[model samples]
Target: MKTIKVSVVTPDGPVYESDVEMISTKAQSGELGILPGHIPMVAPLQIGSVRLKNGGNTEFVAVTGGLLEVRPDQVTILAQAAETAEHIDLERALKAKERAEHRLNEVKQSNVDFKRAELALKRAINRINVQKRDF
Candidate 1:
């Protein structure tokens, strides 16, 4: 089976690096999937989960937002923030989700950044969902 090197990195450091058979994630245009030997391209990634498949193993990573670069031999995700499902704190994610929900509600009655709150809610939800995946 063919594989391409995949890496996900954030300001803190590289969060994931491995050779994978395929990768799929949300792109600004829409859903994007990359395979080995794919043509070079770049797309803006949104707050969502990145799915990676390698052999029989599959993994998930939650990303706030990022840029996805697909090259002939590899794919690199320059994420603003990222976390593997194994590293995510479920309780914290739940709290964040609740906090974002509250903020969104407050926007109706007080000064609040709706867009920011929405993004936060999406990220939190993404994290929670990724963590919930059964391997």
Candidate 2:
């Protein structure tokens, strides 16, 4: 099987580094997928999960937002924040999702920043959803 190198970096440090048979993530325009020998390009990634596949195995990573650069041999992700499924705290993520929902609901009456609340909600949802990926 063919594989491509993948590295996901965040503010603190690199969160994931491995060789993947394929990868998929949400891009600003839409969903993006890369395979070995894919065309080189740069794209803006959105708050969502990055899915890496190696043969029958798969892994998921939650990303707040980032930039994706794909080369013929490797894919690099420079993210604002990232956590693999194993590292994510389900309880914390559920609490965050609730808080974001509450903030979104109070945007009008509480003078909450609508855009900020929306982004937070999306990020929280993405984190929670990443936990649902099946092995």
Candidate 3:
């Protein structure tokens, strides 16, 4: 089978680098699935799980917003934050979600940072969802 090099990078470190049969991620428009020879393009990604399939195994990583760039032979994910299902901290994520909720509820000021709070909540929710999914 033809494979494409997929690299998922974050501020902390490189999260994944592998040759995969396919990669799937959530883009701002919708869910996007890519394979070898996919059309070259770029998209802003949303907070969600990025699924990778190689051989018979599958792996997933939660990403909190990013840029996904695709070429004919490679896919590069430059994530604002990334975490694998195995590394997710459920308690911490839950706390972040709560904090974001509070921030969202208290947006009384005209210049409240909704985007930041929204991203935080989305990241926490995405991590929780990724960690709870079946392999």
Pick by lDDT: which candidate is best?
1
Estimate, for each residue in 1-135, the C-alpha lDDT of model 3 and write its tens digit.
Answer: 999999999988899899999999989999999989999999999888999999998889998889999999899999988888888898988898899898988787556698888878877788888888632
Cα-lDDT of candidate 2: 0.91
Error of 2 at 113 (Å): 0.8
lDDT tens per residue, model 1, 24-73: 89998998889999999999998888999988899999998889999899
Off by over 4 Å in 2: none
What is the TM-score of each predicted model, taking all chains together? 0.96, 0.95, 0.87
Candidate 1 is scored at a TM of: 0.96
Task: Give lDDT: candidate 2, residue 5.
Answer: 100
Clashes, model 2:
0
**Residue ranges of candidate 3 with Cα displaced over 4 Å:** 108-112
lDDT of each: 0.93, 0.91, 0.89
Per-residue error (Å), model 1, residue 14? 0.2
lDDT per residue as tens, model 2, 1-135: 999999999989999999999999999999998999999999999898999999999999999888999999899999999999989888888898889899888877988998988888887788778886632
Winner by lDDT between candidate 3 and candidate 2: 2
